[model samples]
Target: MKKLLTYIIIGSACFSACKKTEEQLYTAQDNIYFDLNFKDLSGNNRRMDSVMYSFALFPEKSVDTVWLPVRIAGMRRSEARSFRIAVDEKATTAEAGKHYKSLEKEYIIPADSGVAKVPIILFAADPALTSKSVRLKLRLVPTEDFTVTNPEYDSAKVIFSNRLEKPAWWATWQGELGNYSRVKHELFIRAAGVNELPVAFDAQVLPKVLFAIRRFKNFLASPISWVADNPQEGYTLEPAGAGKYNFFSITNPGKKYLLELNPADNRYYFTDETGARIV
Candidate 1:
C-alpha cells in the first residue's frame, strides 16, 4: 500500500508538470524572423544567407535600393509595429555612407501583413567597388517590439561592388541596343533607367501604350503630300482621297491612274482606275 501511494504521488507530480508545460507552450509569444529564403527585385526566390549586388549594372544610378524581406510566423496585429535591426560591425567590411547608407533605427511591419521588406541602400558611385567587393552584415536585434525566434535568420549579409560587367542576358537584348560597350551600356541604363526589361507590366503600362496609340492614330489621319518626280513629263499626282488617287497623264488625257503612297514601306505605287496595283 505504501508503494502504491508512492506511485500515485509520482504520477500526479508528472501529470502536473506536463500540464504546466503544455500551458506555457500555448502561451508562447509570436515572433518575427528575417525569412532569408525570399525574393528580391528580380522576383527569383532564393534561400541564402547573403545577397550579392553590383552597381555596374546600374552605371547611371548614383544610388540603388534592394529590399530584404522579413516575415512573421504567427497571427498579425491590427496596427503597425516597429522592429529592430543593427549592423554587426565585426562581421561587416563595407563602410557606412561610402559603401552603403545607414539603416533606419527601426523598420515597420504594416498591420495585418504577414511579410515586410527592409530596404538596403547601396552606393553605386563608389570607385572602390569597381575593383573589389565590400560586405555589409545586418543583424535582427530583439526589442520590446519584436523578438527573433530563429537564430538562423537572425542576420543577413550583402556583398556589393561598383564594377560593371555585361549581364548574361545581354546576349538576348544586344541586337535591340546594338553591340555592348561600357559607354553604350551606361547610355542604355540612363535612357532606360533600368538594367532589365520589364517583362510583367502592371496597369500603369496600359495608359502609356494607349497614349502612344492615340499619337499614332493622329499621324495616320493626317494627309501625306507626295510630289511628282517628273512634272515636266505631264504627270501630276494629287491627293484624291484615301483609297482613290488622281494622276494626270498628258499622253492619255482621259486615262486617270491613282498614285498612292504605302505608309508601311514609305514607297509610292500607281494603281489603275479599278484599284489594281500597277507593277
Candidate 2:
C-alpha cells in the first residue's frame, strides 16, 4: 500500500512539471516583435534600411501635425497594448514646445491591430523655423507587450523647414524661368541659389523630374536654356494643370514633356514640340 501511494505522488509531480514547462514554452512563442514602418514615407511597405528614417514636414501649409507609424511584426494579440516613446535628444535638434510639441501620453496599439501612431505637432510659424529646419528624433522603447526587433528602424526623424530649398533635381537643368504659368508658382529658394521647381507640388516629381533635368543640364543648353541651343528654341520648365508639368520648348509650344512611369531604361527624355522625343 505504501508503494502504491509513493507511485501516485511521483506521477502527480511529473504532471505538474510538464504543465509548467508547456506554459513557459507557450509564453516564449507568443513574444511580440515591433518595428518602425519606414514605408510609411516611401510607400514601399519595406524598411528603407538606412541610418536615419527622415520625414519632411511642410509647416508653411496647413498640415500642423504628422503621424509616425510603428508596427508590430508578430502575430496580433487579442489584448490591447501600449508602447513607450522617448525623445532621443542626442539625435534631435528641435526643442520641445518651441519647434514641436511632445506627445501627451502613451499610445495604445488596438487589440488585433499591428499599427500605432505617435503624433508630432510642428510649429511652422516658429521664428526658429525661418533660419533652418528643426529635427525631432524619436525612439521606441520596449514595453510589456513588445520588443523592438530592429534598433535602426525603431528610430525616426522629422525635419520641419519652412524654407523652400531647391530640390536635388535642379542640378540637372540649365533652364530659365519666364512669366509664371497659371498652373505653377515660381520662387527662388534662399540658400540653394536656384529657383524652386514645385511642378504640381506632388510626391512623384522628384525622380521623374530629376531624370529629365539632369539630361537637360548635361547634354543640352547652348548658352540659352535646358531644352535647346538657341534662346528662343531651348526648353523651359512649365506647369501643366492637375499636378502635372512638362519641359516647354518654345520651338514646339504645344509639345509637352511626358514622364514615363518605370521604364526599362529609367531615363526620361524631353520630347520635342512636335510631340516626338528629342533623343
Candidate 3:
C-alpha cells in the first residue's frame, strides 16, 4: 500500500508540473499600444475621431510560432469585418534560426465586442525570432460585409523599431542642415574630425536636429528651417578640398533634412578651383 501511495504522489506532481507549463504557454501577452493622430503637410496636428485599425508583423520577423496583436477600437460587437496584413518578400527567409517568412492571415473582428483586442498568431518557418524585435507591414481592409469609402483604405505600414542597436548615419554637412534617425533621441559623439577622434559639442544642438527630424517624420513634412541656436557650439564642418559637393538629399517629404559631402562613385561632389576630395 505504501508503494501504491508513492506512485500516486509522484504522478500528481508530474501532472501539476505539466499543467503549470501549459498555463505559461497560453498566458495573455502584453498589450501593444500605438497612439494615433493625423498630421497635414505643414506638420500641424489634426484630430481624428473613433478610428478603426489593425497591425501585423513584417515579413522579415514573421515566424510560424510568432503571435502578433491586432487591436480594434470604436468597433461594435455586432459588426463583423475582415482585414488583411502584408509581409515583405525581401525581408523574409526560410532558414531555421535566421530564416523568416511572412504569413498571410485574415481576421474577422466579431460584432459581440466592446473594445476588443485580438492576438493573431503567425506560423513561420523559424521559431527563434519569435521574441526578437522586427518591423511588420500590416494592412487593414474591410471585408465584403463593409464598404470603405476612401480609396486609401487599404493597409497601414506599421514600424516596430524596438531593437538593441539603432540606425546609424555617416556623412558630412555643409552650410545649412543635416538629419539622421538614431535609436535614442539622446545623441552621443561617436567620433570627431577626419581622424575620427573623440570630441564633445553642445548636446543641446543635437536634440534640436533630432527632434526636428522626428517631427517631420511624424507630421510628414519638412522642418521650416534649421537653427544653430547654440552660440557656444564646438563642432565645425572642416572644408573639403576642391571637388563637386552634394548637399543632403530629402528622401522623405518634410522639413527634416540630411546632407552628404563628397559621395563617391556618384556625379555629385564638392570641390574648390582645383578638383580634389574634401574632408
Candidate 4:
C-alpha cells in the first residue's frame, strides 16, 4: 500500500512538470541556426564557415543539392512551425534560378522535430562554373515563429565549381604518358569518368585511357604539317628505336637532340657532335 502511494505521488509530479513545460513552450522564443559542414572530394574532415563543392568530380551530374542543416534551439512543439531564410544578395555571387534554385517560401520544422534542412540547389549547366566558381550565401531570417540564433552558425556559404586540378598521382603516369598538361588531365577525366585514377586501376578502363593517350599524342604531334610546310628550315625528326627519336637541326645537322620520354627522370638531353648524349 505504501509503495503504491509513492508511485502515485511521483506520477503526479511528472504530469505537473510536463503541463508546466507545455504552457511555457508557447511563451518562449524559438531560434534557428544555420549549421553547415564541409565534405568535399578531398576526403578530409574539417569544420568550415563555407562548404566546397565541385562539379568536376561528378561529371555526369547536371545538378547537385547541398543541404543546409538547421538546428532549433527552443522546445519542439506539437504543431508544425514555419521559419524564414534569406540570401544576402550583396554577398552572393550566384544568381537565383540560374546558377542555383531559389529558396522556398518558407522552411518548416515538423511537429516534435528540432531539426530541418534548407536546400541550396546548384546547376552545373552554368558556363561560369567551368571558368570560375560561384558562391551562395544564406542567413536565417527572424520571423514570428522563429528567430535567428548563434553568431557562428547564423550564415552559411557554399562555393561550387567545375574547375580541374592535376591529380596528385599524376606523377605515376610520367613513364607511360610522358608529361602532364591541363589538356591532358581534362581528356583523362572524360576517358576515365573520374577526377583521379583509382589506386588499383581497373583493367577494363585501360583501353579507353590508351585511346585518350593516343589522342593526346596526336595533338602534340600535330606539327607534322608545319614541318612539311617549311622543310628547308624545319628540323626533321628521325625515328630511333623504342619510341625514341633524333631531332636533327636542318641548318646544322651536326647538332642533334634526343627526343625521348625520360619518365620525368633527367635522362633526355642535348647530343654531342657524334649524336651521342652530352650527359
Candidate 5:
C-alpha cells in the first residue's frame, strides 16, 4: 500500500507540472506578435523594401521563376495566416500572360512557419522583351494579421528584360565609348548577330582597346581586309554608336573610326587611315 501511494503521488505531480508548463508556453505565445516584412532575395529582412527581379536571355532560352519570400518575426502558430497581393496596373508595364504569369491574389504563411514565397515565372526568349523591358509592380495589401510597416518598400517590381546590358567596365569609361547605354549596346549586339558581347582588355596584346575575338566569320557573309591582321579579332564589332567602332585602334590613338555592318554588301566597312571605307 505504501509503494502504491508513492507511485500515485509521483504521477499526480508530473501531471500538474505538465499542465503548468503548457499554460506558461501559451501565455508567452499570447504576449508575442511580430512585425511582418518582405524578405529580399538574400533571405534577410532588414527593411520592408521593394524587390526587383531582372534577367537577360537569348533565343531558345529556358523559362524560369523568381521567388520572393515574406517573413514574420515571432513564434510560429498552428493556424495559417494569409497575405494579399494585387497588381498595381497604373505602375506596371507588363501585361498578364505576356511578360509574367499573373500572380495569385492570396498567399498563405503556412502553419508553424515564418516565411512564404510568391513565384513569378518569366517567359524565355520573349521577342518583345528583346527590344524593351517589361515591368510588373505588385503591391501588398493590409491583411487581418499584417500591415505595411514601411510604405516605401511595401511593393515589388519585376523586370523581364533581354536587352543587352552594358558590362561593368563601362561604369568607368563609358563616355569615351560614345556614351554607350544598355539600349545601344543591345542594338549593336543584335546587329552583330550575337546574343551577347563581352569586353576584354589585355595589357600584353593591346591595352587601349578591349578585344573580344571569336567566330566572326560564321556571323559575317564575307571577309574584310582586317581579317589578315587577326582572323579572330574582328568577328564582331561594336560601332560605339555615332559611327565609331567600340575599340580604340592600337595603330591609331585618339582617333575613332566609323564601322558599319553593311548587310546589303555582306561586309563590314570601316574608314581606313585616309577616312576611306576599307572593305
Candidate 6:
C-alpha cells in the first residue's frame, strides 16, 4: 500500500498581534525525553513495526487526548491487536483498573506489502494534571500465527511559555549571508508596545523594484553591482542607519528574489526585485 503524508498549519496569524498581561515574563528551560519499547504476547521482539506519536499543551492543569500511529510490515496476512498506554508511577496514582484498560482494535497488514501503519488516539482524561513532564508506556496483544520481531516506540513533549510584547517591524529580516540563494523565507516584526502602526512604503515601489531586477538580471552576481544597477525608482533606498531606515535589496540572474526590510529573524533579508527568497 502507498503511504500518505500531510502537513496542516492549525492556527496562524499574519497581520494581527497578541496582547501581553501585567504578569512577570515566565522563562522555562525544562526539557523531557521519553523512551518507548514494544513486546508481543510471547515476550518476543516486534522489529517490523513503527510508531508515530504527538502531544498538545493544555492550560489550567488538564489532561488531553494524544494520537499515536502504529505501522506494521513484513506480515503475511491481516491481524488483530489490542494496545494500551500507561503513565509512570510518579505521573499519576490511578490504579490498574478500568481507566487503564487498553482499547481493542483490529488491523490488517496485506501480504507482501511494503508497510502498514495505524493511528491510536486516546484521551489521557486527567482533569487536574498540569505537570511539565509525563511518561507513557505501550502494551500490545496480537492474535494470529505470527511472531513479534521488533517493538517500535517513540515519544514527544510540549513546552509552554508566557506571551510577550508584539514584535517590531524591523525584527523580521536580521541575518548575515555572503551570497544569494533560493529558499522559503519568513518575516517577523516587533510592535515595540505601539499598537496600530503600519510599515510605510509607497504602493508602486515593489513592482518597480522588481522590474529593474528583471532588466538587469546578469549583473546580480556581486551585491554592490546588483544594487547599483537596480536602484529603487519611486522610493529612496533606506541607508544603513539606526532608526531612520534599515533596508537593503539584491538582484539575482533571472531567479526568484525577496527584499525584506523587516525579515522574520529581527534583521534584514536582501532580495532581488522578483520577490523570491534570497539572502
Give lDDT tens digits, candidate 1, residues 1-279: 999999999999999999999887666665888887858789998779999887656443557788899887766878888888899999999989887889898988898887899999987655566678999999888777677878887889999886556666556544444455543343343223345543444577646434533432332232132223323434444568875556543543333345577787765555332455433
Best by TM-score: 4
Please tell me which model should have the higher TM-score, number 4 or number 6.
4
Q: Any runs in candidate 3 off by more than 4 Å, and if so which? A: 1-35, 38-80, 88-104, 114-135, 151-153, 160-279
Residue pairs with backbone atoms closer than 3 Å in model 4 (clashes): none
Error of 1 at 82 (Å): 2.1
Most accurate candidate by lDDT: 4
Question: Given candidate 6, what's the lDDT at residue 194?
Answer: 20
TM-score of every candidate: 0.52, 0.48, 0.26, 0.56, 0.47, 0.26
Which of 1 and 6 is ahead in lDDT?
1
Q: Model 2 — which ten-residue stretch has the worst lDDT?
A: 182-191
The C-alpha RMSD in Å for every predicted model, in order, reads 18.3, 14.3, 19.8, 13.7, 11.7, 26.1
For candidate 3, which ten residues in a row score worst on lDDT?
189-198
Misplaced by over 4 Å in model 6 are: 1-67, 75-101, 110-116, 151-279
- lDDT (tens digit, per residue) of candidate 2 on 104-144: 65778899888876677776545445447777877777777
lDDT score of residue 59 within candidate 2: 13
Residue 91 CA error for candidate 4 (Å)?
1.1
lDDT of each: 0.65, 0.53, 0.34, 0.68, 0.55, 0.31
CA deviation > 4 Å runs, candidate 4: 1-26, 37-46, 169-178, 197-279
Error of 3 at 80 (Å): 4.2
Model 6 lDDT vs. the true structure? 0.31
